[model samples]
Target: MRNFLVSSLILGSSLVALNTNAAGTDSTTFQVKITVNESCKFTNAQDVNFDAIDRSTGKQNTATGQLDITCTLGTPYKIALNGNGKMSNASNSGSTIAYNLFQDAQYSQAWDKSNTLANTGSGNSQALTVYAKLTGENNVEAGNYLDTVTATVTY
Candidate 1:
């Protein structure tokens, strides 16, 4: 009975040392693989920023353009807002802008020779101008006529 028990113990110890589960997970085959994907990129067509360098400001103007205004009693005030956007594609590239003005309003007359701003690649400057007039009575009040100009750029 002692011999049989000793033989059974040896058989159980050999089975535990073989350990087939450990060998199954060993990385001997080394089947290495990699997957990659690439997508396209585009040049962003964003608009340019516009600003005027001047003394007359909201706190401002043009290819040195001027917003000249004239007003008189019993006569409509005639005013014009003028400016030019002469940005290059290299110095300031791929950007476009426009201009608008408060031409004709209460007690006023207005005008604009160049209305829309077109995108040009010829290195030529784009000019913009708007006209306005204001009608006044004999007692037309006068001071510093001011307005707000907005320039919006999008990317």
Candidate 2:
């Protein structure tokens, strides 16, 4: 009887030790995180072409162009135009014609470095129209007059 009791106590202790090791559990937590930065880019910029302007007509020459931009969703952005606001003659650099850029067809809301167009991004391409006009007084020597305007986007 004494040997059987000793054997039972040892077996019970072994089983308890096994259960304590198997049933015990511990846990910890780690972090999962990410950050999205505001971003913007110009997808396309079309040239503002004033084709065959007849200076003799004594009328304001107008042209329309476009700029396509894509940006992060819900990001606010501003677009500014930077240029000399004049189209220089290729043959004669001294001979130039002054022009104006506007945000509207009515020649209102001048678009320049100071005055910018503001909007919210939709994570897709957005089209913005650029209106350009040359007054009728630009009677200078005009043989392939050209100008470059940079569009800067700020988010």
Candidate 3:
């Protein structure tokens, strides 16, 4: 009985030692990081079309279109239009018309490569209206006229 009690006490102590070892604490670190990059995109932009333009009216023909742009917040950008004023007819090579684009409703702020239009980004979609005026002084042959003006944004 004495030997058995001693063996039992030794086993109980071993079990207690194992339990203490199992309750031991371990520690590590967890980390997180984030990064944001500058970016911009053109959401939408329709062609500025003046359908069936009158060549002999001698009055300014006007049209308006919109361009949607989205970019990172607080970004500064300048928008410019680049293309010749001449709108050549696809069917009739000799027929052509002249036109100009403005940034303001007053037709004063011309949107051209030389004079870039400025605006700030709101981190959301922004609608930019383009005011276009066709010069009525053109005396070219009558036909379907078309022209493509590239809208460029410089940051």
Tens digits of per-residue lDDT, candidate 2, 1-155, equal 99999999999999999998899678999999999999999999999998686655666789999999999999999999998888888999887877888889888899989999999999999999999998536777858888889899999
Residues 65-141, model 1: lDDT tens digits: 22212222222222222334222223333332223333333313233333322222222222323332222221212
* Candidate 2, residue 30: how far the Cα is off, in Å: 2.6
Give one digit per residue, the lDDT tens place, for model 3 in 1-155.
99999999999999999998889687999989887676678899977877564567676678898999997898889888898877888898667778989999999989889888898889999999988899746666777788888989887
Using lDDT, give the best candidate's number.
Answer: 2
Candidate 3 regions off by >4 Å? 1-18
Which residue runs of candidate 2 sit more than 4 Å off their true CA positions?
1-23
TM-score of each: 0.21, 0.80, 0.80
Give lDDT: candidate 1, residue 32. Answer: 75
TM-score of 1: 0.21
Q: How high a TM-score does candidate 2 get?
A: 0.80
How many clashes does each candidate structure show, in the order listed?
17, 0, 0
Checking candidate 2 for backbone clashes, the offending pairs are: none
Clashing pairs in 3: none
